[model samples]
Target: MASNPGPLTNWPWQKLGNVKYMVLSPFVANSLYSIMSKEERERDVTILYIYPFFLWRMLHSQLWISFARYQTSKTNHRIVVDKGIEFEQVDRERNWDDHIILSGIIGYIAVMYLPWAARMPMWRWDGLVLTILLHTGPVEFLYYWFHRALHHHFLYSRYHSHHHLSIVTEPITSVTHPFGEIIVYYMLFSIPILAMFCTGTASVSGIVGYITYIDFMNYMGHCNFELVPKWVFNNFPILKYFMYTPSFHSLHHTKFRTNYSLFMPLYDYIYGTMDMSSDKLYETSLKGRKETPDVVHLTHQTTLQSFYHLPPAIASLASKPYSPNWYMWMLWPIPYGFMFLTWVFGSTFTVERNVFDKLRMQTWVIPRFSFHYSSSRQKDAINGLIEKAILEAESEGVKVMSLGLLNQGEIFNGNGELYLQKHPKLKIRIVDGSSLAVAVILHSIPQEAKQVLLIGNLSKVSCAVSKDLCRRGIQVAVACKNDFYKLKLQLPTELCSNLIFSTSHTHKFWLVGDGGVQRDEAQRRALEGTHFIPCSQFPLAKARKDCIYYSTSAMIIPKALQNVYSCENWLPRRVMSAWRVAAIVHALEGWDAHECGDSMLDVEKVWLASLRHGFLPMVAP
Candidate 1:
């Protein structure tokens, strides 16, 4: 019987989790060891002497953890809570490790008693060391070539990502990928040994030892430990000559295409894959470097709370907390009402009477804060005003004028040909992101500039650029609802710290866009602030939303959201985008969310709808 004293008491789930790991560790080790040959059971000298070392290196490599933690500590310059995931992501790919361990053990066992014709012949004593040296170069060279192929256009999705899965790798992660990849490496390394030893031309013991050494080297390389001496780094003109280090390997993991050679730098250099400028190569140790902003660090700090959670020492500045009550539930009803309205408008309204049908297709119109200006006629009127701005800019020196989101080059690409015909000399450099381009412009821009025109997302981009541009005797002009830019300028530094708007002290700005609705806390803050141009006088009309297409299954909504946020391109591919709108239209016409889940776009909608639905259920699970 269980030892629970009362109905209210039970074991904490965390304890069971810890208990599971402890119980499984030895079972796993013993099970693996059982498949390997023991000293007494071994027949060949190679099996007796060298093979054990190979097994040792593989098992130890798999088991190792402290080394990764030590390296992470040195790199981040702080005590790290979890180094395993970081190691897995950086260097040791997940499936690769599983492949190595499983194939090596299974192949060894399966062929252990094969006839002399079938089995790998043992390496002789004399050639054992020599073969290790000779084979190392060839093995590495082959790896470099094969690795390069894996990254080629076709194989990348299936094979390369298995390794790239954990950009930071760990010991267990070292050989833990798909079986085929492991078999590939095995075939490359083992073929020479089998050929040499089969004819009694080479020592089997040396072959086994070489295998062990290579595995050890691979393990240590991914371990991220700076166990090698400082003198080695200082004396060696080329660190790759000594041995491939974590820094050398990590850069390959981070920048996948460069540095494919393993074991030796010769092949990589000869093949044009060697990276000479890796930041990690300069360091004698992983110590004393800025922290890498990887998932592990954030997981430790925010998710796990193991990094260090120091309570704020200062007393609370605000007085009372909001009470949990029925009226508080009223706040939740607003979103439901909005969703209900959307559903009603989308489904109940006839096509001729539908407000959305009045709007033009493939056209950008500014959104207004209130329903008073939500008419399609008002939308058309706003579009005409923006057209006038474009015409005015075209008539003058600003020949390549745009009204909508200019960051998306596609928008410009579609319409840019018209402008190029009008003004051949006008070179418009559209700024997309402050992080990528504006930073360059901020540093590179001439200090003598008098006036600067800023547009779009005042909270993030325009405001950020304006502040930097202002320092160079530049006055900033924003195409926003006058108050949006003006209020941003007036915001307290604390609220707007690290933002360009915080630096601004003026509100004498032109209203170019329709006033923004206070949809969330952020917008509410902007609305209440004194900087905004009044909504009534606000100017421009432009669409804020973009489209997305999901190419995969509709089942992967969470993954879709993650892909949307985590992927390199914020915009979906054109095919995917078209499918997304089509999916929405299908959904509005009484199609079940699942029924529309044929394309990638439907997948995203299903996912988003599920997330939205999670909040709407009246009763808790």
Candidate 2:
């Protein structure tokens, strides 16, 4: 987390505030039936005659189709967890059977009463026309302006930022906003409704049907799950342009600024708001235009060529050497992990005896120690294990260090006093970016040391300390499991060079490295000593006959294991620019024996520029 709360300016839909319009469709329908003329009420075209039948048929069709599929595919009832894991559905008894009977009675009254008043309006089928009009063009045009307004600097901080709460949104989250926000979000919908209503509109039924259809479309579009059949997606290419596909909307959510059109891409195309279209054909072309140039251009093919890579070249040319900057490393978790290892494991890599006179030995002293709160509220037993490493360092002649003040406040001042009472020996000093305070403290020590142990928020003041110490020619080694875990998880795999959050079904070690080589190797060793319950195959274990039990924990292991090799530059030597790693994984896994429907896949070529670097060499060449 950053030192400050997220900026309000970045909230996705913050501008929608304090707007509401009560929708009384059923009331309007009922009133129409009660007040309508006899001829109007007696018309055969009344919705009262057709509405119940249409609804009954639709519901029955959905149920019968769904049930038939469920019987054929035994796993159809499985609820998708994380990654590829699925859970068997359990039957639940329902006591709300009476609600159906009450609903039918209420429905009968509304149907009979509404037709009488609504009969005159039904003559033109204006409701359907209005609904179709809204869906056709106007909505997207309205949405673009509203979306752009939300992004405006003046309005973004307060009114437009709330919708960005979830980086990845689910369909249920589509309309889940503050009550005030929802009104503004749907204000455009009311335009056509109001216009049609005032102009002898027959749009009431059409509007209702339009809303119901759009709800399904929007829900399916936002749903991360694969709902639309692949065959349909493969055959109907134009459908993607008209209907927002999951990938289409997901890309928008991921990028946030482009692709604001909903229901259709027409407005975005006309307005130049469309960031991507299936017509463009290659996904990478879109990303290539958007990704930071420096990041995308970094090549690993020839070490000599990358020696000219500006950032690393500048660092290498420095008259005085220091620990790697590790600034950008934190932005990506997996590379950060490798960088952490590259630092902590420096003792194994860094030249111990060197000709450089500025280099000196130093020892870290901890006057106090405390375990930080882990992602899991439960006490992190791993923290205790890490604390033992600190103690071990102390026994080996290094001082265990503690923070005198956290970024929030003085460590021992308010909450620190009680905390320090438990561990008194650890030194506490107010550390910001100012190195003078730390230097004064370090100078006070008379004994020469080889290493300094840093504890607490290493990325903050500790990062500065490491840079300062390493610049003075000290081998600055950092031991942070949290840092290690985070970096390792984000390291790219051969499948995709870019870092992405590894999808895991299990929540056990989300913030920890459960899949790193060290982590997995530890588990592999532990399994020999004890019978470990493989949770991935049997999450919340039950009697099962199938041998292929999906273990939530095991799924992430592949990515984590992939990280070690990917970071180490082992596999996927070539870059496949337009393909997503997940897409590649799906293709490679052969889980679905379907044909490679995307024949255009071969049209993709590696950017000779993209594969410029073979991976940052683990060693200083």
Candidate 3:
């Protein structure tokens, strides 16, 4: 259960246990036996062998819990929670003691078969050498097949799923499994001995080393931190062909169905289960030590918005307190309205960069928060859910959390200022990443164009954008629901000189407002043009290739808000800019948010921040 975990490799008694298990278990048992009488010696010697193995497991689990609890390389999200769609941790923990006892018995049974009288030790270096060869060959190959079988839906539901419940693995997590799966695995390890004895190559010395080495490597695989330094594999290129590191196996636990080979990479490469991201994840882990982030970003889809993403969560909602009222389910046909029934819940999906860790990023998804939102009262409830996300990030030692898309409404904007004012003790800072995205959109606007058509030009953001374009030596045409300026006489000199009043499409580069209704037929016709930026002023209009595309939404770590409320909305740029900006802010917040100057012309510094921190667009090579 890992009831209480320490830091990685920080167990006070682990190295002592490892030394006793590997180098002295047999000798210790002999010393204890020689001191006893014959009858007692025989009775206790077998039991003595089990003690070292048991101690090793205890040490391994303790260290693993530490590694999992204090993962510095990346965040490790708990796969099993007390109450949620995920399997419950309590249910798994309840049977932990029994599992250890059964594993001990199985360990005793396996070791008892090896004859102690003719045991070989490393003094006969040949025995130790052969053991390594035999274990990695037959044992690793067979275990790969065995593990793949466990992933089958039938076996998984009954036996193997429990092990997978902890996606972010701790060292003890390597050994935690259903009794049936554990028993089957114990039997699999026995196959190496059976093969060696059958082939007349069995040596007790080799068996001892093999047992110790295999378990040690297994513990290393589940530590959830990369222990192998880059030089070991990079300088000695041949080792890369054979070795599997903690980052390698951790990916198996995470993405699953990849990197199934243990102890060696050879088999995984030969087989088809290796993940392309395995090496990248390893190098990322090796390089991810620059900064410690004090914040994380969270995003979600509303009920009607996330209706498709809700079946599994909703089906299991009956067991959770946040289940929707029956009436909400009745409105299922209405996507937006039905969302009112759901509550927000999310998990850290993966660890990203430490801000300047090569500037690469990691992310987590806050899948939901009480689904109903939009109305003034419902918005209040949504705000509470927003606080829940902030608190989660705060608990995770996150210093800052960035709001993206619908997460930052007009009332909820400004980096969750209300949250900080109300929850004075909560240390997490709120950031709206759009400051950078809007900067990008403003910076990216084509100043070379002389004429531009503006749709829903009366909207606040769009109106500001239009006036700014007029000031930038470009002609601006404004369309609005109500004619704000009837003629040139009514407009300011700067805008009236370049701007043309129009209720119809002008076919110039369009910067459409996110909202406001006017000349419905004209707007529809304007959308089909070869060049047009869609109705979102917040992400800004800076596209030329196509009329419709999803907004990239940010300057740094751009994100595509395509699945939920924003999916129907098109982005001017293909990549998700909003997510990128949020990703950048979440990764590290060493700079001041005040640097995002309000004036579009004064955005060079902010634009440089975007470029320096990877907030720029993903242009083709």
Best-matching candidate per TM-score: 3
User: After superposing candidate 3, which stretches have Cα over 4 Å from the reference?
Assistant: 1-292, 302-355, 358-364, 367-371, 375-377, 391-397, 411-417, 420-429, 456-464, 481-501, 516-523, 527-530, 535-579, 582-589, 594-602, 618-621
Tens-digit lDDT track for model 2 on 161-256?
Answer: 544443433443344333334446556655665555556664435545555565566555444433445456479876655665555565566567
Compose the digit string of candidate 3's lDDT tens values, residues 237-316.
98986778888888887777888786787777888788898888888776655443454545554344244332112222
Model 3 poorest 10 in a row by lDDT:
560-569
lDDT of 1: 0.38
Per-residue lDDT of model 1, residues 1-621, tens digit only: 012122212222223532322433443454346546456444333323323544565456534543444334334422221212421142223223334334345435434444442334553654564465556666766787888887875566665566566555544445544445656777787765665545555544555566667767777666654555557767876865646666667667777888777767667777677787644453635454453211100000111111111010000100111112343353465434534564344211101000112111111112211231235454444333333333433343321112223212222222223333444443331111222122323433334445433433343323434555454435555544562446456545544332232223232232112223222222222212223221111222212222111111111121112111111011221111211222223323333222101111232343344334221111100
For every model shown, the clashing-pair count is: 49, 55, 44
Q: What lDDT is obtained when candidate 3 is compared to the true structure? A: 0.52
The lDDT of model 2 is: 0.33
TM-score of each: 0.37, 0.31, 0.44
Positional deviation of 280 in candidate 3, in angstroms?
24
**Higher lDDT: candidate 1 or 3?**
3
